[model samples]
Target chain A: MRKIVQIVLAAALLVPAAAWAQQKGGVVIRSVSEVEVKQKNAEGKEEVKRVDATKTKVLPGETVIFTNYYTYSGDKPATNVVIKNPVPDHMIYLDGTAAGAGTRIEFSADKGKTFGTAGKVTVRSADGKERRAAAADYTNIRWTLEKPLNKGAKGSVTFRAKVK
Target chain B: MNTRTASIIVGLLLCLVTALAAPQGAAAATAACTGIGNTASVAYSVAGAAQTPVSSNTNTITVGNKVDVVVTTTDASPGPAVVPNQVDVLLHYTITNNGNANQRYQLSAVDLATGVTTSVFVGNQTVTDAVLVSAGTATTGDNAGAALATTATVAAGGTLNVTIKATMAAPPLTDGAYDVFALRARSLKVDGTTLEANGSSTIDSAAGTCTADVVLGDGAGTDDAVAGASPDGSHSARSAFHVVLNNLSVSKSSAPYNDPINGTTSPKAIPGATMEYTVVISNPGGSSATAVTVTDILAGTLTPVTGTPTWSSTNGGNVPCTNQAVANIASGGWACVGTGWAGSTLTATIPTLLSGETATILYQATIN
Candidate 1:
């Protein structure tokens, strides 16, 4: 009887420990701050009048600049904190200027199959002239931090380009 | 039981329970969470559009004539809509001249659609004289059976007055809606004139055409007529006339040299005497007149008005006289003396004239 009681107690403690480990392994992502973007016309008037990012029908050659900042609030340092931005069909990527440190930038020319230096990728023109392509020419852009971002660390990226 | 044995038993049981419970816990966590949650979104917006009231005239113009049509558009919204608020339209036209003389042509308009026809005549007269005449559907081409004649002669510098009537065919347009039309005119001539072929000479000649367009506000009372649909639709204009002249004259000094002035003139001076004659003309209508030329025909001793007529601003003016004898004038060619006098025709052009404006010419002859 004594042995049985001890075994039951040990089993209960082990069960809880295993469950806790599994829970710790699962990722729990939450938005720490709201994302906001803005755009203006040639007259410097804000054009946020009729934009619904989630459901708006954007026309060809129309531009919407995204000025967004995000924060990581999880306990452990977040690895591979990649920001994957899909380039819209009608928009050419302009710039990826940083708002803070701990952010590295890279671009993909072939729809995310591979990434290369944003400033070093060469595009050949129809006349056989090779020229450096802009970040906007890529299918997507990713910003990887040099080190795992600690909790409560915030950073931002700004992108601009014309509608093609 | 012994302490060692009890501890071992407990460890083994614990290991078994943990192994069993670990899988169960993971399975339970794997199940997706289900809950009834509601999401709501609110948005505010202001929508607008640029409204322009466009107006124009129809196509099909008479040869050697022109029409003026207007098309006006207004921005309907009080505020600005999206960018690029422009409207485009076309004006189709045909011009014809049914007279004997060749005619020069020009056209102007704001919109290509409004069929506003304008032409010069001698005063308010039919196009019988050498001048530009407006050809309408009722009167086009050389067929006398079709075209209406001008009331006065188209002197070289004389202007004619004409009125434009825009007829809107039923189903009145909406108050703010735009109505666009077109007008065109051009000169016309016999097609085979340039060829050497001895083509059959026929009075039926092809006339040329020119056109002008204008944009006006919706005639509807609900819309402002002069202001256009928007605040940016206004225009200013000035009117004037340009004139050109060609002179034909004949001279004689003795009684035996009495011969009526014909298109051909020889400058012959009698040994003992001298004579001179002058002619004058004027424009008494509205609008510019053009293509003016003078021709002198001498048939007998009677000396008709001498030299081409001079231009004047007033209605009636005496022509300068020449010292030539009047005995050689043709019996029926004398203006004042006989009922058979054959009057001569002189021509001039004013190019353009404004309302209440006038152009004149004078002629005179003397026999010594």
Candidate 2:
């Protein structure tokens, strides 16, 4: 009985408790990360192979690509979709790497309190001065879908970060 | 932008904690098993009503351990000065662990030429918490009570000091003999003193969940580290022991002065002629000799006409000396006992003679 309860509890923790996800024609989101590895192809030409970051050794100073895939299955078109992701601990966000089709990108340096265009973002320095934010200073990234998404519309957003 | 104008900007924050995903390595390598996990969230509205947001699954990656060490000679200046047949010449070195994890090291000292380990020490000591303890075991090598352990375990960013002791061979050592010793230290595994190797399992099957790998990251040190490897696993330093004894030497010469045939120039030691004798006492080694005195005698055919002997001092090399000729009084001049041609007996005293220093003494004698 205890084992059964533990299994159920584990399943419950893995799934989100949002009512929209339980209903049909709802949007589903999936997040994953990977690293680019150099390998020789059949033609003997060097090519970059994407390896799953979670299943491989990621050392310090190595770059990791974090991606978010989304699918809209609603009966009507969904609008005003916004996705935000915070920079992971011990990692620095890469500049101009947050990309998505038909979406407006913004950055936040103060832990998502406010957002602005990448160049317009600012951060306070240790010497009591405010200056333009560097790539490492970005704490969160926001992607706002520019167009409405109908049923079965699928797209993805991605950004690169380096392990500290 | 779209026909629908419903915008809520919902904040859906999900706290998914990953094990071993803490901030690490403020100024050093990150902890080997640190796992960095991230989770992203999304929020949207259907037509006009805002819906509860959802978060994606967590993804985590672990950091690998980088193994590196440093060994350096930390002996005091002037090194150890040993005399002939002297035992237990001491040299010191320090080993530091620069890796992210605790590690053990194998330490030893060998001859630079023959690669033979002849300087094993006894009574090795370890100090902790202001308390002293020694591994008191006598070995074949002459010992000044240095650290004698062949293996040591040190925490990350920790250091250990080792002393290597050597004995000078009597029959082979000259006045200035030299011996070179190499101190080597290699990283070791958990048991039985095995050398640490670079880990090649790039894909650890279950790599991402807080499991760390090992990599070589130490640079070559004094030819002890392997240059072929990307980074070497061992470090070494060379220190030398010097034999310094032969410091005292004496040389003397006599010249004719004020002779009837030749006065002070082109003169030989003829009858009724005065000769000037210059006695040089010098130190040629790397140590000091104190309370030095020179004794000479002039009698019979040679009579001492010396008012006072003059001496000058020159300091060079490892020796430090000053002229003490004013204090050097020649006693017992013209003293003879039942003898023919027993030159005047003269004795000059010098307080101290340093290494690489010379003192010249001159006096006059008349031949009859």
Candidate 3:
């Protein structure tokens, strides 16, 4: 029994320290939306109105604003903070809707893994001819912060897409 | 065989068998991860350290409860009424659920306003409510007045026709009197929540609850969070109805008079004899007839008489159409004879013939 105990302790010491290390710092992401509404004004002219999109139903061919919020709740600042959002199915990303201050916006034709600025990203056609990708060709959106996000600091990036 | 050679052969066979069976076990282990969840991962780096990656807890995006609808009236201008007050005018409207989810809608009729003249509905008074009926098609059905049952549900991308049978006001409304009817619709949720009208919401798959349902975006962001216990909400619109009438028709006849050979009451055409012509314009509807003008064009072969034409109504009362205005119209048409007529034409302008009334014009012309 003494020999068995000695061997068990020796085996435990051989395990890597990284296996038990706790995560020190991280970020949290949340998403929300806004929708456009049209109602007749007192003069009976159609006026555009904005409304909350929570639990709201959207029709086909309508526009929706999708915002992704990111907050750093870590012990240390995080660098190269990049956020990515895939365009929802049955929706087309509206051009010029991506907006985030101090962030570089890029679009992806491939699923969120690779991104480039519009007119710079090139895709090969079925006939093997290469052409600059249009904004409508984007399937994913990415935002890379210009500065490191300090702990407890938050920022949001938004874009609009139209229901197909 | 040599022992060394036989042992090597046995070892090679065993290695081949193990390689073939290993992939089957790996494939079985890989097939067990089918579940409902979303995946999100974020990566960051610390000073002097390589980037570390952390994956979010399995989150889910639920299908949002979005309610959008549109209501439209069928006709803009309905015309040519056969009779007023006796005819029940049926107006049609279609309500469509233009949202992304199924929904129930409540409908009601609001009153048409009085003398404030507008081209479309602008008032909100609930008048004598008309009978509302639901039908599969917009046409070919009649239903009595009753509140639409609460259970009537409209699916996304579906439409329903609502018919309002408005009984025309008694004592016959005056011609050109207008009334407007407005149709209103409100959407209801199964949880008894009235969804906002003509609105929509979207769920963020990365931030929404992938593990469980979590409702967010409560009016703080662009998305309006539906207040779960709020009152039912509605969208409103209006349509107008105008009073008008069908026109009256005119008929003409002739008889031979003072004939030396044939009888004076003969219906045949004759020469060297006097002929009497009668023009009758009748209004058979319950609406007033406006701009009643009768024109009689005589052939140049017939000479005009020296006397004025006599006019009468349905009650045998003679209309004093003594003076006439002879006007040139299109060819093959008739004009009423008047004092200024140098040609073979006759015309009488009688304005404002009341409903259910008839007017007649009698003139005399002789054969050349």
Can you give the TM-score per candidate against the true fold?
Answer: 0.30, 0.61, 0.45
Query: Per-residue lDDT tens digits of candidate 2, residues B287-347?
Result: 5555556667665778776443222222111121121112221231221111112236665
Once superposed on the true structure, which residue ranges of model 3 sit more than 4 Å away at CA?
Answer: A1-85, A88-105, A110-115, A122-136, A142-164, B1-66, B77-82, B85-88, B113-130, B135-151, B166-171, B191-232, B249-368
iRMS for all predictions?
A: 29.9, 10.4, 13.0
Pairwise DockQ winner, candidates 1 and 3: 3
The CA lDDT at A96 in model 1 is 55
Go through the candidates in order and give each one's DockQ: 0.03, 0.29, 0.11
Task: Give the number of the best model, judged by DockQ.
Answer: 2
Candidate numbers sorted by lDDT from highest down? 2, 3, 1
Model 1: per-residue Cα lDDT at residue B26: 15
Scored by TM-score, the top model is 2
The CAPRI-style docking tier of model 1 reads incorrect
Model 2, position A8, has a per-residue lDDT of 23
| Candidate 2 displacement at residue A119 in angstroms | 5.2
Deviation of model 3 at A4, angstroms: 42
- All candidates: CA RMSD (Å): 34.1, 18.4, 24.4
Candidate 1 Cα RMSD after full superposition onto the native fold (Å): 34.1
Top-down TM-score ranking: 2, 3, 1
